[model samples]
Target: MLNKVYFSALLFLSLTLNAQTSPCKAAHIGKFQVDSGESGITVIERNKKTQTEINEKMGYKARYDIVWIDDCHYELRNRTVIKGKSWEGSSPTDILKAEILKVVNGKVFLRLGSNFSDEVMECEMIKIKS
Candidate 1:
């Protein structure tokens, strides 16, 4: 009877821990920072249907309309360049694909690519706020 009780307790504890570690879609709705190497850091804020990115060092800010294909994948359609005259060439029709490759602790590994180009960029974004 003692062995049975101990086994049940262990099973319950394992299940409880697994539940706690499960990922939620809403967890990614927050502010994050991406180190853009020579370009400096880019701060990104994600919401349900939109995402805003600001590169303070470059004096650039842009907003994108997000179309979530799935929990892990999404497309960003450039809506407008809120600041920076250099970004005026950005087309509203430009589409960028982004995927959340993995989330560990407070960092999210992302893969980004452009629909009009073959180039792909991968970076780790540190969560700044949730």
Candidate 2:
């Protein structure tokens, strides 16, 4: 009886561990929204190799090529502006680095930075669609 109980507990533990998947993997293909302060909401849709963002209030829409450095680290490159003007003085060749800090509830927190500057921005994106 003791051996059976031990085996059952081991099985339960294994199942629990397997159920807890890494957040980065789940985030790869999802629709997320980030509040862009006064500019309104930025809706982002990401796939395996691309990310697209649209901010209607800002009249901005762009698509980026995604390069995954690791599980939690990735870079966005080759931005193609589809609508509105690009940021002043910003180049299309600039790379944006992002690190997944954590996912709480339905929100994903990130450490966002750029290859061209030392500035790092922290923001959270709410999962809209998985």
Candidate 3:
């Protein structure tokens, strides 16, 4: 009886670890769109080969250099100012980080900004193309 109980405990532990280690995949490298609840939609383009990302919304576009911390997390350094919008009063070198919280059925849930901060934003990204 003791041996059977030990075996069951080990099996449960292994399954839990397996679930926690499921990382994001390379197939997420592509463009995505989310409705902004306004007249325009927000577009995000990620290029894993180039290690870059472009975000466009409300006629403004910003580019970032991506540094992958792991398969599920990455840091984004704002490398360029919004081309179609004026940035005369703001710093051009802003930074942000993002993590893949979950991926289900080709849709990725992303959390943006520092995890310690209370202002983190969550967005769902659907792959549009490779």
Q: Estimate each model's TM-score.
A: 0.77, 0.83, 0.66
**RMSD of model 2 against the true structure:** 3.7
lDDT of each: 0.84, 0.93, 0.68
Over 36-127, each residue of candidate 3 has an lDDT whose tens digit, in order, gives 56636666777863233333544567676777888888876655645565346545455567889987777788988853345888988777
Clashing pairs in 2: none
lDDT of 3: 0.68
lDDT of 1 by residue, 26-122 (tens): 4358998989899999999999988999999999998989898877888999668899854545568989998888888888888999877899989
Error of 2 at 31 (Å): 0.4
Residue 129, candidate 3: Cα error in Å is 0.7
Better of 1 and 3 by TM-score: 1
Which parts of model 3 are misplaced by more than 4 Å? 1-23, 26-28, 49-57, 86-90, 114-118
Candidate 1 local lDDT, residue 42: 97
lDDT of 2 at 79: 99
RMSD to the hidden true structure, all candidates: 4.9, 3.7, 4.5
